[model samples]
Target: MTDEKNSLYGGSQSSDAKSIDIYDENLHLAEKQKKIFLAICGVFISELNGKEFDVYMNTKTYTNVPKNANNIKEFGQINFESKDDFSARLFDRLQKTTHPHQFARISSMLKKMCSKMTSYSMTNSPTKLFYELSLEQRAAAVAKWSTSQKASIRQFYRTISYVARTAFWLNPYGIYPAIGYPGPDPEKNGPRFKGRTFPEYEFIKITEDTNDLEFDVVIIGSGAGGSVAAARNSVLVIEKGHHYHQSQLTLREKDGYEKLYELGGGMLSEDSSMTVLAGSNFGGGTTVSWSTSVEPSHFVREEWANDYGLIHFMDDDFVDSIKNIKNRLGVSSSNVIHNENNKILIEGCKKLGAPVATVSQNSASKLHECGWCGFGCRYGEKQGAAMTYLKDAKDYDVKFIQDCFVKRVIIENNKAVGVEATINNGDKKFKVNAKKVIVACGALHSPALLLRSGLKDKNIGKNLYTNPMAAVYGIFPNKEVKAYSGTIQSAVCDAKENVDGEYHGVKIVVGSCHPAMMSTSFPWKSPLQHKQFMLQYNHIVPLLIIARDRDPGQIKIDSKGLPKLDYKLSPHDAESVIAGILTSLKILVAAGATKIGTCQTEVEEFEIVGENSLNDPKFLQYLEKVKKVGVSNGQACLGSIYQMGTCRMGSDKAKSVVNPFGETWDVKNLYVADSSVFPTSAGASPMITTMSIGFYVANCILSEKEFVKKRQSAMLGTPNSTFTDNTNADKRSSRRRSLLSSFGSKRFSMSN
Candidate 1:
């Protein structure tokens, strides 16, 4: 029966036109408005369990009213109000009705209302009111976050954007246009390469046919760690994801905007669990993340140093390694992108009597204030790893094979051998025979890869950390400034540390506008309001704060061995969020914000405790309530870069998978050089940290001849020891002598 039903509706049948119901509550809408609304509502209901929707008058109660001129204009007014209220009214009415068709009708009405609202005049309209409302919302969210747990506004924005993005992606149709960002551009709405053709790999000189041979060492994952490791070892790096060079960014055009998913095919892990971040393409997170590199604070380093006896790794050795890595990767403060938005942040910091410092970035252009960093600078400007390390690795004879996904490392007798990978484009399998292997597949996927390899240490996929972030929008009464015209990031605040148990990271300046992101961040109930806000986009200066989450999550492998991250926001994590939010509120207010708002429901009124109301019991209660939730709520979105310390580095094999040297204790020729080897989550972004680890791990392996010699000797002892040669012994002896000469005497090195 199901097949027959599908067949009946199959084969390009046009959808039937929606029929109108005169007695229905939606009958009062104009014929044109009704048709549009019905179509939209049908789409929404069809996607959302066929729930009914019903149109009603602007009054709080969902009742039909006479079609007077006032009522008609009132429809616009109701739609112009905050979409939160508008959606609530619309859904409340629909949920009350049992009519199946009602769902379609209500959905359609909402669509029409959204279109009308967005169409308002930018010069003078209710849309401008929405920005004020949004500020009010953010202020409230921040106030609650602050006094409650010292969370900053940065956390609020990150959490809200994440949750809303997730919910919207799952059900695009159910999304009320007024509550979310604008839809994609009509011109660039479809797939860019859906039907486009290209030359086959068979025709390319650097094809499988040409590089059919295996490598002595194979490195999987072309990220910070993997790329550096491959460079250090001159190993062949096989990246299993699409490769996009900085030069390929077509978003240089004024109208150029990257499609969200295609920006890098970002994975939104299971919503029921923690957010685990993983990159499936070349350069990993560096390709698409903000170019903010930070070193771990002395306190954090000392903790790790003391706990793991990694004093050498934490101090002089680590600093020397970073300095070398920096030079290799071209980390310099030569070019800075500073602009009005950046100046504003600095001025605001000064206004608040706080010191503002220059935020170091990796952009080669260093324009001080260009807003194109996140969107891939049109000019070959920003020196992302793709333009820096990857190119350098290639220069150093490190071959990179894109689109070759390594499935698992070939392990036998607890020693690494080679790797088995699938050509993602085809079912054809390939193997790279490597005497040694390095796992640089990042935190989220590295654990999954290990789990798939059948090495089950209980903590192989736990202790995930992300510098969860938030932002506060400073709403000025006038539209004199254009925030988006400046640099993507500018000034930074160094006042970050955990007071008690709560933690936050570096605070930086932020500025950008692609319309859609604006809509998500701005509070607009109507399309008209959105248009007006766009006119005042210059007036919105957002302060960005990234916080280190005390909450850690675990990366679980699904039945298919794919990663499933379960994030549990610890009580302390929530406290950090609340604290972050409150700090933002104070900053915005100090920046001369007339009104404030937030994303928290409990602290709505407390956000604007007036001078007279400062000691109000209601305000105090609101603050207390937010504190309670911030300290307890575990479901909030807090982590980013979704770092998983599943296979952490430690001194003992029983407690951790890797040793202090980043080599797996259980497996001899296997090493982890990604964020997965981090013994503790850094209170900052992990790009530089991962890169340092890669360098350390690779150098450690390179300095040793015993690991490979031991492996070679063991392989000789085994029955399947293939490709035996006396040359390996010669190489081993030479390497041993080189190591002895290199570290033989500090007096010899110092004398030189």
Candidate 2:
């Protein structure tokens, strides 16, 4: 065994200069910080004694591990390998995504955890540190903290649990083989058919001291919006993340997050209310999003026009932009294959006579049944913006700089000039002068960037909205239902949506979670209890109830000048979320699930004995129990993959950060063409809406008589092709209006 002090588990630096120089060059955390991080996570890993291990192994008749090991120490919890320690993986993630300002907050949290250990007297040793606690003491503390009523106590448990479980499930060296999860093997996991083979894109990689960059238009993101806006000639796209073609895509959770996500994935909100997942890599959310491509609902568009005074939302040009984006991306419901989860949703909805709709995906050429959509697509079937829009931009000679972070938009007298950025984490810095500047860094970072650039407005980072989702897992013991495979998301149950007729409520959708996501989200009670739940992994199907929050949260810049969410679930939305959960439970009952569980810690699962219906006395009592507890922050895990409305677009200059034309009110020729500019909650996936806004913003630039150069004029589309809207939804039969008489909108107000 290697000495602990000299080990690569983020120990003290060795005296040798070559090894220290090489690894130290990339190291972001101090040796003490790294040690503290590892100690905090190590305590939560739940080291089991011999008897405890036996109890956990015998908890369930089923086992997710194909070759379930009996040894407790070999699981990597009790004893860690030097090279594959949690600190190495954790710091690697930090160096890639998290900024120093955020790290301070994290470090503070770690110190708090240590203080908690000392206060609880868990560490009987003289050191009185969390790392010095006995294995038995640490395990007992985790049990108490996981279900604690206090938010601060729960925060310690959740944050450590997220990192610890990720270290096991996401890493190849941790527990992949033990859990039967095969890491990224192209030959084994990729689709059978060889998908599209893209040409070698000449992305200018910044390796050395390169300077003096210039362009006609400089877009500061590579997401659903920015990729579409890159249609003009002489466009230079600066993406904070690097690109990966189909072959280079790593389907592994750990590698995918390090490469593609904002703040290294499983990102929680400021108050730890919801897990906010935002993409940051080459194609942004398009590269990492579940392939469901939904447009802003009709009611939302009307709301933007009527309430927000953004009448252009319903204009012909706006409608035309949506239509054009759909055509370009080939979004359709034709020949779609529903996975096990979607199939269960459809079957259950039919039994209850609920309205279900087929969702369109960007992949229309062939079946994109490859289940790893949350990670980048190795199959190249899903038509992400990188595949379609950015490829088109490249064909039109639009140059792109990969792995570049824009410091701020260079404004001269409040007029857009260009951008200043650092490539590959401050290795090289340069300024790109441009005629137009587009801020499309998504809902989270776009506002943060504006705040950092000395832009002041009450509405800069306000009006933030998310489609917060809660999960109800139904395990079918009779047959195999691998929820992680096949088409990720393809169907929806809108029986609960628009219950108010003003389009405010919830929608039921299916999600595809790999092992890492599943572990972090799967509700934990005790070590043995969680193991029992996970043993049913292949049989469990999740129905995600997404509440379209009415009361919006605001994004505030923290002391580090970074974006932080200052939002909580409002009473109105809490009712909606709880109502959706109750409805989902009924659907699962109708689907004839053997056992049903929720993300909430207090709610007990209702396992069927012989046969049970929604109206059965036992199930009814369980439903009552769920409603009694309701939804609250820190009680359960709530997650949101969708974020919007931060740098909002509206007609009123006083109310919105950007105007209806997508230009910022304070700055001329500077635009925001992303989900950040959504006037309100889109109430659906914002991919198509975001892309259409980008398309519209690009046209706005082209229409400008002063900025439109001769070279940009050649980008005029020659394809006058008009396609039929075969992807028509929302035309449901009137009989579907019957939304389960037992649980209606009136019952949602559980004030009694």
Candidate 3:
């Protein structure tokens, strides 16, 4: 071994991991490039030795913030776990967690990224290895990349930063202890939900020796869509993810990503301009999301009917569908207790005279003040798909098999007969023979599934819209505790939601944040500064600037047949995001924030000098800096919380993958019943919209008690139902019976 003083890399291997060597793994990258990549990782996350200890987070060489302004304090008292072999821990997890090919691609990119970073850094020659430079010099190098004149350089920085920071804050092993973050809180001692447990569902695990099964219908997902569509008996819902019950609902940040989210909660667009978060568990997003139950805005409905030919979206049936689902889920804002974050948002919006409204939750109107909603609701109060639709279907003996990945739909002579799938990551090959098939996979995966099934419709993966969001955080030091433990979005602003007159604008709301989530999404200024912000996690509150994106992205499959999102922030959408950021800053200042931070990586945080209004000259200048920096390609941190619009439902076959009834245009008897069927972006939380569409499409399949009958019955009541409710059970059962009997007798077919 080389002498300790002459070590080439800054640190030793991470943790106790022992396995494949990066160089031995036949990667297509050069040896020097691989070393360069490892060095860069060392620069971002390390143990902070004698020369590296920084208390005040002096980053002024790159950012314009005042030196030693003393807004944030040093955290020397606490014993941080990251101080002991953090670099080693991070690399150990990276090697074990990331796929080999993906790692190779990242290493190759890192070499190029470092060269450009140094050139832009205005430091020493690019010949020096990035890690060999002083700590500040290295951070300054990376900081310049965000403000680089070249878009490519900016994108490179964004990609690298995302990979590095997410690796650290998403908690490989040491992060929770290092940052002092608590894991899932499903305890009896809590004030809200007390010692409640979910009733068990009969979930079968698919095995290598499992036999073929037959059902009346086979649904290829278990989210809000598939759960509702499983209204018929003899139905089989195949889920790619396993069932995460109450005991494991809200896992720790890292565990949650591995167990509940798609792509380990790090899926990104092709350009890395947006981070896409989608659930992969049995209940899907409804299980893990913030449960913001909202009906479609009226303007969005008008667009679907007038522009996209989705007339039903504007009809009374749609309204009834939303009402029926909302009633069943008990979605209401009555019992919401806004956290300090939410309270400040409302106060600031009100002070600015911006229109604001309370956002509803599907927590059964129970007092559920959980900031960890994104990890999956620990409390049983969240009426997710599993608790509502799936629970209802369970009584009818609708079967379910978890850990099943449906490979493709089985098409025989232009009809979907069933589906072929591999369970437990190809441990078992099986086929489910069914009379009808419903592909209820969310937007990101539905298109890939269709394409894999050999459907040639051009719109299968097109027209995708994610209500992309950017966040701005404010520091409220006066709060006794760090401020993020209650409800996640109890309020939203309509001040700029319809700025484009077409409702193609933005919505402002408070985001649910915990330490791991807070730190990862917080752009890294320097190691010390980033850690300092993590120390201030409790005092920080982030506001989401969500946009009703007019521009669209598409989902495409890679050589491995996995979904690859292709999206870039179009100029118009970028403008809307910039406006939202400025508006968010204005609100923060008005709300009496001592310090406000923007997500743009190269920008300086605004520190309150004195008492000031929104129009204060210094604050106005900061706003201008924000606007000028804008949503530069990959420079600003943006996220897609509700991905939608792929495989959209419409009348024109050339423009849409599915028909008005949600049946695919290319094949009969196969339908899509997820957010993918939205005529455009739902322009609101998509849980209600996806569930309503699922309910509507399921009715279409059973040839429901005519539209008029549903309208009349719905008009007479509030449409609520419990798992044991039999009010509409007979009607639903009769429709399914008639449809099944027709199929059994060979007297009816979906193609008819």
Candidate 4:
């Protein structure tokens, strides 16, 4: 067995049979080289000793030095006139160290000292210590070190550690032949996909020849809600996006975004204040979401029933709908294995005495291997709409048309007759007649569709609710938190629940730590700072805050009929987020994090020492600053994964676009069966709720006495004698004129 010292610091025996030691009469080195190595190590020890005895031991004096020694000049008290002079001195010292073995020993000592000093200082600091710094400050230190200094401290340590263990030191100063660090090979960390294509199913390509297709029911959008509705009824589903099976997924960030997201995953609010990440592929959000299947909270349900006049949501039937959706989607918490990221949240929340729960996911335990859930589940373990509802609908002879963009619903005599669409960017142009048409194109796009179809209801595109989200990252220097190892979101903290007034309804969940996603969302202080954070990606744990916004925004269409999201954070919602940040800080401190920071572009971070430091007046002042400069400034990194209530459903036609039964109030046969129909925010992940809404709407359409009778008559090949021509030429002309006047010359054409 190899000795521990031999394994750590190189074996005693060398190829030349010479013993390695600090003092050897045969080993001769210049006097200047020795002095340089000692000087460099001395400077490093001075900084470390300062942090240990002055900053860590004294709480009041902590303010004297910057956290993490970010300003090295100030922290080190090095006066060489200018930064260039300081670099020159350091460079001159490194250039003089010629003997590889001696330099390696010196490097190893410095590296060991750095590691020991960090641990020792943190241990001696107050029982609860938090470091408040911005992403810029962290990145700046790394950038400054790399650019200004000729010899990198990190690189020097790596070389020394490698040579000490392997008896090979690279001459960094160009004196001897150069050799790099002989560290062990790094483990591969890229994603892997092992799925084959799903069995082929019959689908229409919607070319010119097949453009004039007809069906009993026409469903626009093949996502969560549309797929459910299609399964309930053997409907014809028209998806604007192409369908790709699990096998087709590239599992790369750029490829996934281009193929599976709306607008190549670059969709942002009109003012760019928030990024809206909604799925645009066949399976919709389920294909790209993290598979967290949180059901609608009782508070949201009660609010909808009592305030929004959605009383039917409280019925027993709705309960059954939720249960059925849950069962179908395989929502379960038993199979979840919380990764280090989630474990941190659990530990922190437990210590803080905050309410936390394991998140229920829509994935099969046996099949899920903790793959990337944000990308399309290549293994089909996730029971998204594509795997379950759409598959079932395919078995039931439902005709699915891919790459078919529906332009508008053909409304005549106050009822929807069919829809006109251009397939695959004008490869085919035609109309499809149907008894009923359901719009499930999400909250943002659903309103655009209605507006383009000449729907004149005053509430056609109002009351849009987005669950605005932000993230806070904790740096746990002592632990290796591989945030991407397990499921993306396995646990949640509900500490901000049920606060008085509009400050209620904030939820914190573990967030994805995928390299690409984090790089874009993490605050950018400089290129060097950003790179430095990326290096420690595995050690960082991120927590996401989902706030239920009280103030509603709106969705409008531009002149060309494209959807434009107009949302700004409300004062109350901002307060809620700030409160969440404060609570997250407490939780992180409890979880034993040495540093905590929000992802906001501009905000101060805290390096905490001492258990009750959070209650300090200085810390409270920092919280006040965060509140004053909220995330709504259009510069902070804010995002929304859940959107709802654009084309709301309610009892009053004057207040809503659709009735409680999900049918459009003005247009008889037009219905909405998606998050667009949600009367208000669901206050949680909306996958199951959206599915339930689809189920309920389909049932409502099937149960309608008139609709059932009409279908039966049509099936029997008999013309109902009671049917009369309700179309008056003057009324039709008036409606057409009104639509044309409102939307310029763009008009809906009918296939006679």
Candidate 5:
């Protein structure tokens, strides 16, 4: 009867049910512990994911887990013994003993008993139990808990770990702690190189000893000055800088652009007041220039010859060379195809009775589409010397040695024999042997190089001048202009004159600077301004004007060839800036702009009904008064060319480094072919002037009786590789020289 009853109900014969198995106690305890851990993880994950419950458990994707409450009960039943044991252990490990009455009553009796036992075990050996878990197990538990709760515990851990890794990567503090220390001296006893400090093999180690670096000419910089020398020599030319291919230029290249500034060594002033931005690249200023090519003023040319005493070098010969350079570089009148934005500027200037003429540029085929001329031309269209003169020089045996940084000009017996340099490839240093050495690095850098080379002239870095530049913005109503899609500068208004004894220089047309670049230059509170302006990019037009200043700034070089600039604005310069702002605003208003904003002033709205507000007598009188005040009272003013007369060329050795022919007056073979050789700032764009001088200087070197004789002999019976098969070369070689010679003779005869 008992067996029949047990079978009918499916109950065990003993009726007390199964007892816990002692042999499987440890395994059962581990299983229960895992389940508790899983429960904790589920709660955490729910928080992390911002979910209400353990959705993963409920989802059908997890094959091994129960999906709902019905299945959970069944699953818990099979695992009930282990679960009870874990609960009892956990309860006993707690310092505070009593559970709430509700929990105590609802829990199974076995579970309550196991929880007490677990609590006692934890109290006895909590540390040992934690140590028993492997790292993988801890990580898995943490991950599962975080995922289940979605509360982000794992993310916190990851963030801390990442910070630790980064600290290791960039830390330099742990470098040399064990050396026997003298006192606390900073140099030798200070520190040694830490682990992985500098990048691997980025620079070629140079020393005072290496095979005598021999070249036809050792060009100090690879910019406008040196590249032109290379073109003139038509021989193996070596530029002491990196060769950046057109394809390599991108937005990323601008990050390290300032480092490559080894060209000018850089410029600064003695007063320690200002910094100048000049180009120091393979293409020189052309690489970062605005492509605003303007001819030097006629007065400037005359002053260069009659006043500065460069009489022999500044005649018709110089003028003809400039014309030739313009032709070679393809500097032509910018046209409407440059874009419609340019037309608006022209039209605006014309409407204001200040007609704007098309500015000349070196770019080809409207390829300045990037509108980033100052960042190096991504397209080869900008006729920088790199694309024209330097390109031709390379074809004519001019070997370009990129990444060769000129440390100093080598002086042996007070004659410029060669240059000392840091090579980009190896540890060995070298010296270039040259009959003539030219310093074309630039205004700031040329002086630094001279100082580093130990050529101490008290006036070496003095008499600095810069063509102060500034921009003005106009907001037009109901106007949409895609400003960035066209040329950087298309037209310019030369109508500006001295309003009150203070010169405002020439007013020129301009387009918008790139958004990213604008952010970098004017980064404060400008991002929000950028977003606002972005919506009005089409309606916005900018005007850039170059101003001539008598503000005598100077660049001084430290021992390390770094420049220190001292800038003090002459009263005239400050007034010029104000005039520039007022003039740009006037033009925009004339063009029917609805509003105007300046980098230096607050925005203002214009009423069409009150058009006379622009020409109010009070306003004009205020501008005239303000034009006499120097520097910004509330206007934005930026200067582009901080040119110095360091290493300047003159007739007297006592006053200048170079003579009228650009040769160092004291040093026989040393030459300066760059702006360093300029007698003055040229009071206009110096691109053509500098290149023309470079060509003339190089021609003087090659036209020496010895070099010319050799060239004539080399060409006699052999197909001269130097001469091009094209007709332009024939004209350049045959007709150009004769015309220039006749002009030079006429000028000399007149002077006599």
Candidate 6:
């Protein structure tokens, strides 16, 4: 073995010798061995036919044998001669047993024994018999042990074949075993409430008799930015979508997509080259995101400051703003536990001498690692906008109106006064009057709203950025790695820095293996071939490559005033993606993966097998083929979660939509507070950076004495002319007369 392999396996010979002695001294191995022996005996008993055997099997004791399989006495009266006869029957029945779950359990136990023996051999040099064998080979050798060992190792081969058959029978689509998140439970957990503590409106009946509502400040979109801004000020938040409490979320992919995601989870770019995943619910992306809380990179900050003229990004106050947001969200690595999926990436990166780091998350406690943030954390442990800032805003008596879609900002003389909106998609229009209006509707919709509102800024919808991502899968034979069992995206490999070149900033992170997601991403050749891959689902490891592209895209409004993304992958960025895939493949090989596959469409089920494939010349040839076919044809299944820069922030009004403080350059009292104002791609996950920008904008608004003074003055009726109802009184003359009478009565009562 090479020195590197030795280090990876454990340590040098002399060091291993000492380690072996210590391990032997602490041997609880005998107990484990006894348990395995009993488990085998239990399996034999399960095949026996007798009243006693039936009674014992019905007790469900055999199910626990994988932990502690019992001796013959535990099964009751059966002699040695009978045992030998039963063993013969078991050998015969093993060939015909239709119980796939039972056979799977037996196979798993035998594999564990093999792994234990391999570890023992690796530590104790004198017993290095199976130390170099692959996991599959080791498992095969386990079956050759003596009959006295209690396990029927010979039947294991049949069980393996049965698993393949059963896998096909179970999944027709060749999907991974479906693991579901906890669904909404109204009886047990009550409503989601999200962050709202104050009263909220979901159904509003605005008739002619009803007067227009007035507020000191009106905020559109109840996402991360809107919620934070609302907390410090008494604002009325108008959300186009409805709120779903913890109990309201169905936790199924189809339901979540339809209810919580943008465009029913099928939002694509104008060219159909990328699928954009953005939230359109109460708390927006925070409610559905993976909870990765990466701070803004220094390179990105410096670039924005020096190149884009957003100098405030480098200020100490801005740094403090980021720190405050981190503290509020409890962003830290302390609660993160690297599961098998993440551990594989860490180990592989270490073996290949690549930079790796633990990802900080917004988990409230270590005990709250449920691996279901994509479906909304059931435990409310994720400190998203709904749980933190929006909750705080509710305490300040901030009102909220759900399902109230704002059509346009009510701009009078180039200044935002309020907004005009429809309630519950109804025809009855309502006008909300306020001193200022803030748009926090995310990157895609923010610019579209500006365009629909008749803003003439040339840069309103330009400079869109997306962190394009692709995933690679590694299958390790005979290893059961349940990738869906722990926290999603717990670690990252910094392959961008390791590669020698500029514009190659790629972050390779662990990806989710949820059944629906995996089925779509894993490349398929035919139904049978796909089923074969799904059978190895438990052994699959996925690595997601997020490439930071320098080239920018644009977001334009369609004829219906909806956002349309126009992005074409640049050659340099495409090459960077391919580079990331190669590095990911090398890491997988190093980590003992037996086969590798890419999500690229034109790759045509190409796979690299064998431990030595990393050193094989064909490996390079395969990668070259991937670069030619996948990158050139844009065949890689690409998606983006980190969307930004549509309404970019800068110092120049002619070049950008929003200023460094998040206020629009073209419209007064109208500010933006989302990823829309990001000047460029934040070379990392943009959650914390986006939240930090929100805090900075909120602070700027709070410090604006003139705006605050105007808001106070408007509330006290100093700007009576600003509150325009614009309702057609002729259609409802009687209702209008009644409203006028009420207004006259109110004026008389006030004068008295």
**Candidate 1 residue spans exceeding 4 A from truth:** 1-212, 252-266, 272-279, 332-337, 479-485, 501-538, 601-639, 642-644, 705-752
Q: Compared with the true structure, what per-residue lDDT tens digits does model 1 show for residues 636-721? A: 43325436466788654566777666777667778899988776767666777788888877876786665434432332241212
* Candidate 3 residue-wise lDDT, 251-329, digit = tens: 4666666567776666667766777888887888898888799988877875675455555665566777888898999
RMSD of each: 15.0, 9.8, 8.7, 18.8, 26.3, 22.0
lDDT of candidates 1 onward, in order: 0.50, 0.70, 0.71, 0.63, 0.49, 0.61
Error of 6 at 608 (Å): 4.5
**For candidate 4, lDDT tens digit of each residue in 15-125?**
221222332332333444433333332222122234433432232212221234333223333222223333333332232211233344444434343443442321232
Query: What TM-score do all the candidates reach, one by one?
Result: 0.64, 0.85, 0.84, 0.69, 0.61, 0.68
lDDT value for model 4? 0.63
> In model 3, what are the clashing residue pairs, if there are any?
14-88, 14-89, 482-538
What is the TM-score of candidate 1?
0.64
Which should have the higher TM-score, number 4 or number 6?
A: 4
Put down candidate 2 lDDT per residue, 1-752, tens digits, no spaces.
Answer: 11111112111111322222144443344555456567656554444567766775554444433545643224424433234545665554444333344445566655554564444532344445555566566566666776777777676566656656666566635454444445564343434536447545778856566667878789988899999999743599888766777666657777676556766675667656577788877789998988898888877876675555454565565677888888888888886899888899988899988889898988854677878778787766788878888899889998988767777788888787888877544557889998788998899889988988788888998999988888888988764676778888899988888655567789998888677777666566655565556556677788898978788998887654667866788878877888888888878878889889887878877887656477688888888888888777677778888899999986566788986567887777788999999988887899999998898778767765432322122112111112112242121111112212211332111110
Of the two candidates 1 and 2, the one with more favorable lDDT, higher being better, is 2
Off by over 4 Å in 4: 1-199, 365-371, 610-621, 706-752
Return whichever of 2 and 6 wins on lDDT.
2
> The CA-based lDDT of model 2 is what?
0.70
lDDT of 6 by residue, 17-83 (tens): 1221122222122344433433333221122335534554343221211222233223233221233
